[model samples]
Target: MQRILDRLLDIFPAADRSFILLRESHSQKLIPVGVKQRHGEQDPNEELALSQSIIKEVFTNKRSILSVDAMDDDRFSQQASIINLSIRSMMCSPLLVGDELLGLIQVETNESEQQFMPEDLQVLTGLSSQVAIAVKNAQLNEEIEAETARRTSLQRYFSPKFVDMLMSGDVTTALSGKTYLGTILFADIIGFTAMSEAMAPADVLAKLNRYLTIIQKLIYENDGNVDKVNGDGIMAFWGVPHSDKSDEANAVYTALQMQRHLWSFNLDLQAENQPPIHMGIGLNTGDFVAGNIGSEDKIEFTLIGDHVNLASRIEHLSGRNQVLISEATWQPIKHLVSAVQLPPFMVKGKSTPITIYSIRGMESHEQNGYIMALPCHILDENGRHLGRGILTDSTPLSNGLCLRLSTHMEIERETVLTLQVETVEYHQPLVCVVKVNSALKGAHGGGSSYTKVVLTLMQEHNEDMIEFLRPGSCVATNYTWNDLKRR
Candidate 1:
């Protein structure tokens, strides 16, 4: 369109400016899409006003118009812009396809001596037909390209086979809404708010995109559909628009792989002297309404129901680097993974408490000690006894040994304390200084208050503690703090 307008301006050297004005379909306002003006002349596109102008006349009459002394011409004399600019002469032709008016092409001169003649109008009318065809073809190509991009974008959130079914009209009947049993997984970057605040905007965007790319790849690898990306979080699911018996296991596998990949991703960050990233994931299984949602013009394939909300709520409850799953999801994959059963907890919009399990890892023979009611003694910084607690669980990771303490006292995060293990595994007293990582307070079913504290052994004592707490080690049972002091 711009090339056509430029050619028109070239052929009419006396003209000061030329423009192609097309009507916006949605707003019905004429906007300039192609414009050319002489040096030192005001841009005709910027000054265009369709109302009561020569261009409007050409459009309304669906014919060519030639005006000599435009400001003095009765058709445009009252227009303030025409009078202000002292537009002396002009020629315009309606761009038409069949009987429909698509737009207008106009050229104007400020000098009365260079007034457009009938011959110039004749030439413009002839060019207008070709220009109309060109413009229509351009618009059609643009629409096709846009539609292709839209489908490509949808592929990011849906399986290719599902997209094919949708595009082929194979699933039109199913799009109206149908109930399907599926597993939903939600995950978000932990501490994203702080991370974004500390980095430059470009860096923040790059880091976030990298993180989401890793997450999306894992989901696709496990055959899960990425339902949506909400800010720093992602909601994905499996078992619709297609389903298989392994949906539950697949979702769990994806969550574990995401966690493992993120750990390696953090290593790259550490080498760059950037803060490591962590995420929390939640999974739930239930029936949900899956179909096209929204207005006809802008509908989307999505899921909706209480289960989706419950999955989001569960994700909200997950701590950094943790994967939490609902009972429904757990039941199908319980034998396939190792998870610690969390105490029943109340969630918003639910009448009863829901049981959740924290995934440890895939099923393996390598056992990290299980959670048990074993006695332990905690000593504060000054060697003063803070309280007694039960050692609920112990897990050995590359960083350090993780100990879960069920204690009555509030253990502050980052607090360093001495723990005396009273279990029967070690003949000698096992004392270690540990740094508190997190402390979660909750009540038991019998109404007893306890704080579940996760602690990591200080660097120097990590190896010693690992050996002392190694799997299947023998130790004395029911030992007390006093017995440790005597030993």
Candidate 2:
């Protein structure tokens, strides 16, 4: 740009000053890109006002102007700058391409003895057209460079596939405010606040990065796009910018694999004499608005809606090293995985409670087994309090059920006991008799030791109760119990 301005000055030697002022696209300010004075130095950063009559006239009319005495010109006679500069003869031409005005070039002669003429205006007019093409090309190159930098920066937070979609211009059209049926997964490091408090900031970041890297790799392997990373937690989703029928199954499998990976990671931590880290995963499947949201200068591609909020809330309810899933997500993949239904708990911003499940593992074959945690009151034949336990799993087809009991009472096989179970379908508790089949230590560790007992339902189990216990049968929907009450 400087070289071009220098040649223009050479072509018009009689002019005492020559400069190229370019209009900024963002601020709409005219900035001096190149400035040359015949005898004095010029400030390249100086800004020129759009109110200057000679420059404004050329810019507004998109034509060349030749004023023999600018001070005497009726249009600029009262203009302060022209009068302060002490009576000038000037010529200016608009840098234009088609209907777009980019800027203007101005040349001034302070000496009244050397005035601009019509032929001088014609020469500058021809040169202004060439300058306009050059300026347009420069702007194009600048925009291309900026776009490349933006894509490179986005790669730090997004997957290569996602960034490619953004660069291809397909996401803008396909995902903008569109509702997509997808699975959202939220994973958070358990006890992160306490862990950070004990460790140095640098160590915390290092360990957090290692954990996030493990999570992000698994998500990508399962065809999920990371929405955002919030400190020690990450939110990712599947089936956006595209869709697959197996999105729900993919999400469940991803959560299972993440747990497996964490087990191996803990082994490494144990070897290094560092405390093992635990994580909680929550997943839900529903419709969400997926798109770029924000203003012109800043935007983000993510999912938003009640679906997303519910998923985060469910994640907060999960326990360490546990993967919890909503009923919506479990319905499709119920047969492929084993989960113990937990008691319905109330969630914030919700009028009624939601049922959640703690995933046990993936079921290998067709089995009639159901895992659940339901409060129950066990009594001896004489109506005496025998124990209180939680029903963990049941297999009515096999005539067997599993319970994690609080009491260590001496109970043997064939021991008759009356069990009262709670139900949402009826006001009365479902009553039945059962014989203890076996007893074993609880598989999970932590608080008081629980005795896991196997029992056989002595009476004919109600088909409705058995059906409700089956996987995919008792999952909750978006409609809360409150909505049911209103109806």
Candidate 3:
């Protein structure tokens, strides 16, 4: 029956038809998506409307209409189109899906004298029902496809719960990456040389995997991405990926969880007659390149820069079950965790001794880490310019989302931002790096602010900067934080 209706509508001469959806007996509505017109003068179309109206009026009367003598009829003579195309006869039928009153269908001709046969209306009614069913199915298919696309996007990066939040229109994670400031946290296991030797090869692999599983979970629970994992060391930057002013809080929370988790694991190892573990963790606040690398065929979403390396160095110096953090990390995370001052020690190949901290506590009470009270600047390729604001504050990073500078600089919208924010890495005289947070924007700043910008290292700050930052420094651009947040 449906197929028959389809063919009949396919041959219907009317240029347009109304497909009705019967939602309720009293609430029938016609969804007007489109219309078809006969390939002739405009007059015939007007006549067609008149003819359709007559057919529809008779539908509720339960009367089949097949009057072929159309144009000369008194009922249609008053219609403006009567003398236009000289349309004569027409037929109309009730379109139904089962017992439901779907709609009405009509066919018309330009010949003024030919009368429609009763059989014509029957054929049209049959075809109209098929049309209604096809339309309904097509609409349903469209809705399904749209829903599938949404699910695919959410599942690609976030957990089911987070994705649900996104579907509900929460765009907190959508903060675009530009240039900003915040803290970076790096962690690594201590003495892999001796630790690996103490166990069988297979045992080492299994143990390492187990450690990573817990570590990754803790980091994710605190809303930070693992960033990058190398051997036993991990470089996790806060204030980006997923962001807000409280990103520092998240980083601190993650560190606290890791500390507790490590403590628990150490106890378990003791009970199992295994050796306890030691670790090094370095936290710094700075800017670095964070993004996607490689060809489209293959790509890695991660952070890369001198800041990333400095974090590893700090981690390398940390000891068993201890978190060795830098002063920069202390700046933002101190409030969230119980940090103890460690005696300053000089790193290899440096005259200055780095002040370190011992991360000893977790945050039972939630709070923010850093504030935007510090003086800030937004620089660009053309030198310094005022950007949006003082870059007053920033969030800690885990999604790899970088912080952004306030709009205060005079930089070109196309210009890249080379920031001079403080970093918490191993501050070597020749090698210093900051984890990046945001992109460059236009603005202006000078005097002490511009001087604070570390153009380079030569025992003293470089008066003329040779160091330049590129757009890849944006955390959001490289890592696809969108996916990470969903995860």
Candidate 4:
């Protein structure tokens, strides 16, 4: 642009100064990009002011203007800028390319000795066309470069959906350090060191990629972002770059699906005479700091805080093929999932014991409704009747069931119980054997005199009763205690 300005000054010897002003796309304001003055000019670039009326006239009419003396020109004589800045001889041309106005170029002189000619305006018009094309190409190149850099930097941490948002200039403010409520998840392969030691280097790399690929796919499918890879583990989170109401639920969904998908993957290994691999996933929800952190030369977008550390701590406590979560993560999703509350645990960095829950499976919509009161028979593994209770709910995937009893049963944890209930149509018994996962006693002295029992089907036993224990099959039957007892 400065070269163009200097060339224009050389072509028009009468002009003392020339400038190129381009309209900013975002602000729609014209800003000076280049300025060239004849030798011995006293004023700096800031003092170079153009008449608003003349520039506006050129743009509005899509033409050029040549004024021998602007104080005598009817079109701009009344303009305050022309009178205040001193009457002058000037020429203005609209920079345009194929009907689009890019901005304009103007050349003027305050001396009475030099006045622009009609021929000079025609020459300036042709030059403005070439200048418009050059400026447009430069702008497009800048946009492309910026987009490429943004996508490359953000793809290292965020998913593609979020990458699009950041490139579009939305939520770019989130890159700064700020506190945000989010859910963090950590998933690690169990016995990874031992497994790698037993395999070749190429085999280990292949297996690790396959494992991490599955986890990465599931996390993006549930609208979460991968923060970083921690050795054999992956650290991911939701609610940075933007916030979503379903953040916690999405995190839980990703964790559960990751386990299910890995199990399916393990079946292939077992068939090939290779040892099956297992993984442990943990999730926690709380406020954390999200931003780009590191030295001036190297930085990465990641999360940091006590909540982030707690998520990793909880993952360390997870056993093989298990998904565990902090109490904060369970509060909002308890109604949607079936989980077992574990004893309070003492973590390394925390001063108090933290409550944790092991996620079993998702709760089906049919089982999330009000608990129905129907007599159910509980038997031992030998099919011998032990006692009776009220069946409440069943979880999805046919993995677990919930029951309420009148008195606390002396059943030990892990005790297998054969649960039986009659159907409404045929009055035929529907039975499934489940091991006791938990048993809690209510205050027997008060009106709340009931014991809640959570039961889970062992993996070996689930295949035989899956169809019977499936979620939608557990419907409420209209049978009274007398009808149930008579049978």
Candidate 5:
């Protein structure tokens, strides 16, 4: 543009300086973008002194104006800058592409003997037309490049649907930093350390890719944005780029489906003689600030807030193959799903205890129940018979059940226990294997005589356990192991 201005100045006989003014994108006001001066040392401050009245007139008429001795012309004589600059002659032309006025180019002379003629105005107008088209094309190319860069960057964080919304030129306000009522989820593989150690690096990478491929697809299918992926962990959220009423439900459903899909994935691994994979998912819903955050060189569209951290905390609280959700997340979808309320536990950052629920599944036809003092036989992983224990509680909606055994008898944590439980619903006793999660010593109808142990079902037996514990599917008599043997 400066070269164009310089060339124009060279074409005119006595033109002292030339400048181009382009319209501001946001504001229609004109601003100088390019300037060329004859004397190079011309006072920079004196350049803008050109008559605004003449420029406005040319822009308003969409044509060119050549003034001879502007100090005598009544139209610009009252202009203080024109009179003060001692301007003698000037030519202004409007730069237009079709009907859109891009800006204007103005050239002037201070010499009194040199006067701009009608032919000068015609040449300036013709040159301005070409300049307008070139400027428009350059501007369009710049916009296309910017949009392409934006789309590529956004694809890393958002699903395709959301990427389209962001690129559609609508929802401009939502793109800025703002508070959003959204749902955040964090999921990570269980026993990843052991899995990584057991397999070769190549095998681990292939397995990790398979897991993530499934997770990524499910998130996009649910319209959730994947914020970041760190090794075996994934952080995702909904209600960004745009918010929908289904944001919370979609987040929960994504978590649920993720677990459901893992079942098949694990089955595949088992068939291949590979270790079955397990994951823990946690979800929380609340207000968070979402936007592009980083230095100028690198920016990431992610979420930031206490709720986001809380979601991570809840994820760490989840047991293997469990989906844990905060109370806030469970409130809206409480009626649509079945969940087991876990005890309120204190987390790292808060003074008060946070309440969380273990999501079972979508609303179940069976009511949740607790069975007490049912007899069961416990065996070790090798099928060797171990001491018998009493089933104190049946939590089919959660990831585990509670068993009562003698405190003196020690059961190592993570020890697999094969349980042969007799239920009246089926002739054959319902059999399943579970792993000891935790053991709590307590006094139950006696003086600290038993240890209450928490057990989580092995992945292969989870479905069988749920079916066995379903209400009305199992009848638990208050008979202890001793009483049943005596009868």
Candidate 6:
């Protein structure tokens, strides 16, 4: 900053004088642009007076204004606008840092008819860009320092990014209703109720937030959001607020990663004679309602729905330091992970059993896996779905049911599916795909690319797997026939 500012005056021929007008997020008037009486020097900080107006202008137009001669430019010819005894030439460069307009820099001279050269304006313009970036960074560093002080004073309650993002007002995507599939993760400190009973509330909160700081950093690294902190438990998600397909895998991976990180975190805690903490994590993936939920007084930018609830239950059932994931999350990632199966347990309020898996290692998981193929599209090496029907196989087991497994690709195909685990007569949870089968393949096909997928069930829990294909029950990836009629 000093180098650039020095160049503003020294690199170019001297005007009368120049100084930066520093206007922060607030308090625009304290050092208002124009003049400041300092050490018997007149207008030592004249740039302060017009800072408020200049900042406002730069933000509105997103460009700089050069007043080669303010006395001639009608906009500032008024005596009230004259913050200093400026008789002739001046140049103002807007201090812009990225999209934000920090403030303005104006150089003035008392010399009459002394025109400010383009070389002067060019130097100021170039320097102003650098100055803007410096100003923004300085402000950010100040905020970071202040925030660190505040957080340290409060005993580290939230991660730096969480506080910064919220303060920046960029949680629009976190709000509900936008559909995205990603891993939802939950972590709970085992025996927290018992621990809380022994410790004071303030001490408990301090310890809890400290532990969360570690967990949150790990989640942030994996591109996940800390949905919210509810007492002893934490809810978080990946791939929304920023979308990515490996969302579920990332969540599951983070869970495993946290367990490893905590080993060190807990070691430090133990050295301090603090209670060692152990946690359990659960991950699930499905269509979830996302948004800013709650009352007028408060809003929660997080996820909701059965998927979130189910993930919580799985976490509760998971042992200390365990990363348990649901079957829905497992299907797409079974190839990428080696999960030891947990005995199926019925979730609360739900009669069906949810098969859970614990990841042991990644090296073995990638070895014994099937190819990833979507319904109507074929995926290439770059993970982009190119052609269609690439999952062709000889053992096409078409029984009218189509397994709606969301792969890294998005395809609409009528491939052979087994309804061994059925949601609808045609809806299969996990389909052993044999080929890239389709009902429509010509230009005359009735359904568009967005057309609802039709899936026929092949199996049910109580009966033979093939009995589901006997008709009556229909599974669809797109829309029902009744919905088509209305369309």
Question: What local distance difference test score does each model get?
Answer: 0.73, 0.74, 0.50, 0.74, 0.76, 0.58
Q: Which has the higher TM-score value, candidate number 4 or candidate number 6?
A: 4
Residues 1-487 of candidate 1 have per-residue lDDT tens digits of: 6677678778998898888888776687777887777766545546544335666577678999888778778878888878876788888888898986778888888887888889988999999888888878888898889778967976777767666766777666343888899999999887899999999999988888888998998898777888888889999999886677899988987887687566556646755678888788999999998888877677777889999999999998776556789999988776656555665768888999998876655532324433222346889899989765545455555434334333345656788888785533235546878888865344221112234566777868655555444533322234332432233
- For model 4, residues 1-487, the per-residue Cα lDDT tens digits are 7789879989999888888889998988898888887866536634566688988899889888889999888988889999987758998888888787889999988788889988888899889888889999999999999888878877766788878876777654433677899999999998899998999989888878877888898898788999898767999999886777778878987887787566556645645567778788899999999887776677677889999999999998776656789989888877665555665678989999998776645543433532222346878878887666655555545455667654335777788887775332225655666788864433131123345677786667555345443322322334443453243
Q: Which stretches of candidate 6 lie over 4 Å from their true place?
A: 1-32, 35-177, 200-203, 263-275, 294-299, 349-351, 364-487
Q: lDDT: which is higher, 1 or 3?
A: 1
Q: How far does residue 107 in candidate 3 sit from its true spot (Å)?
A: 16
Supply every candidate's count of residue pairs whose N, Cα or C atoms clash at under 3 angstroms.
5, 0, 78, 0, 0, 30
Please identify model 2 stretches exceeding 4 Å from their true place.
1-4, 27-29, 42-51, 65-89, 112-130, 141-183, 190-201, 217-231, 237-250, 260-276, 286-322, 332-487
> Candidate 6 on 1-487: residue-level lDDT in tens?
4454445555545465666666657755323333322124454434334434444555578676666666776766665545456546767777777776677676766667667877777877887888778778888899999876765542233335545554555445242456666678899998898888988999899989888887888787766778788988888887564566777766776776676556556646655667777787888888777777776676556677888889888887765556778888888776655455655678896888877775532311332322111223333334443332211011114332222322223434544432222121122333332233454333221111222234443334324323212212212223232432232
- Give all TM-scores, in the order shown: 0.47, 0.54, 0.44, 0.55, 0.53, 0.46
lDDT comparing candidate 1 with the true structure: 0.73
Give the Cα error of residue 385 in candidate 2, in Å: 43
Give the range where candidate 2 is weakest over 10 consecutive residues by summed lDDT.
440-449
C-alpha lDDT (0 to 100) for residue 92 of candidate 5: 89
- In model 4, the number of clashes is 0
User: All candidates: CA RMSD in angstroms?
Assistant: 15.2, 13.6, 21.7, 15.5, 14.3, 17.6
- Candidate 3 residue lDDT tens string, 6-104: 444466644223222233334565432233344423343343234434644555664446656655567665666544545567665555556655555
Worst 10 residues of 3 by lDDT: 468-477
Stretches of candidate 4 off by over 4 Å are: 1-127, 130-134, 168-176, 241-243, 267-274, 363-487
